[model samples]
Target: IIIGEKRLRQQSKDPRTPPSHQPEADITPSPSPRPRPPDNLEEGEVEEVCEISTPPSEVLVVEGQADEPFSTDHAQRLIGQIMVWNGQIDRMRDQIDSMRKRLDTMQQEIKNMIDVLGRI
Candidate 1:
């Protein structure tokens, strides 16, 4: 919840500014290249890539999940679980949309307040 609140604070800092008004640099993602070692490194020393481009090349997991022998009961349970997860995802999406609308309304109100103040 703390992390989420921090993200919300950062997002609302400039809620009055629409995405289109934001600079291209701020909207675009920055490239992440592996960092290079300094030239002052010792002659025999070697520097590894500071960035992890990919996870371990391969992961061998024995019996990652023991699959139960095919059974109608298992299939039904799996389907029910999937349905539950889908419903949860849909609810979260709806909540996010609702929050975005509220944010937009607040931004509009702020803009109106500024306009009214300007007229004074």
Candidate 2:
């Protein structure tokens, strides 16, 4: 992305200025240089290099469109929802534990009553 930004900035230069005169940092090296024709070759044999850089104006438009929602209000709302869900989960776990304890106590009481009746 940074390289693309640099290329876009380079392409925004004035048309009158030659690339050779541009600042060194603004230039990016190509993967491979095009092979030059022999000196004796005719002018028609030489290939024209096509510039493929994106315009800086278009880059600005794209960057503007990619801006995301990162406001504090949005973050706070998400955090609040998470906290509410967490609290509800904790309450549910406590209720389950309380019910288990009550069940265990009832079973013990029933066993005690059965033993007492058998002895009688």
Candidate 3:
């Protein structure tokens, strides 16, 4: 029985036997190479090329103040708004907790009333 099984395995492994049917894989051609900058560009030349590429109006110049982008007044207003919203959220959470406690107490009372009526 082992010899017969070995013969069947050898027959299955034969290269002359046709392969199982399978869909052919799609073969796509490789994309073309991208253009690159020349290797011999100097530091100054590179900076000049970048400056030429960018428009002047898009560039920002901050002369006097380092933190001009975020003024103290704007920061204070944002902090005030955050504090007000935080207080409102705390109040809403407290109200929800109280409502849940009331609901639980009412449910317990109704259960007790039902038990008393059942006893009667």
The best candidate by TM-score is 1
1-120 in candidate 3: lDDT tens per residue?
Answer: 011111111112445664333323333332434335567876556422211122332323333534334567987999999999999999999999999999999999999999999999
Q: Candidate 1's residue-wise lDDT over 33-89, tens digit each? A: 435567898978866533323233222222334423346897799999999999999
TM-score of each model, in listed order:
0.43, 0.39, 0.41
lDDT of prediction 3: 0.55
Better of 1 and 2 by lDDT: 2
Score each candidate by Cα lDDT: 0.55, 0.61, 0.55
lDDT of 1: 0.55
lDDT of 2 by residue, 76-120 (tens): 998999999999999999999999999999999999999999999
Clashing pairs in 1: none
Collision count for each candidate, in order: 0, 0, 0
C-alpha RMSD of each candidate structure in angstroms: 23.1, 21.3, 30.3
Clashing pairs in 2: none
TM-score of 3: 0.41
Sort order, lDDT high to low: 2, 1, 3
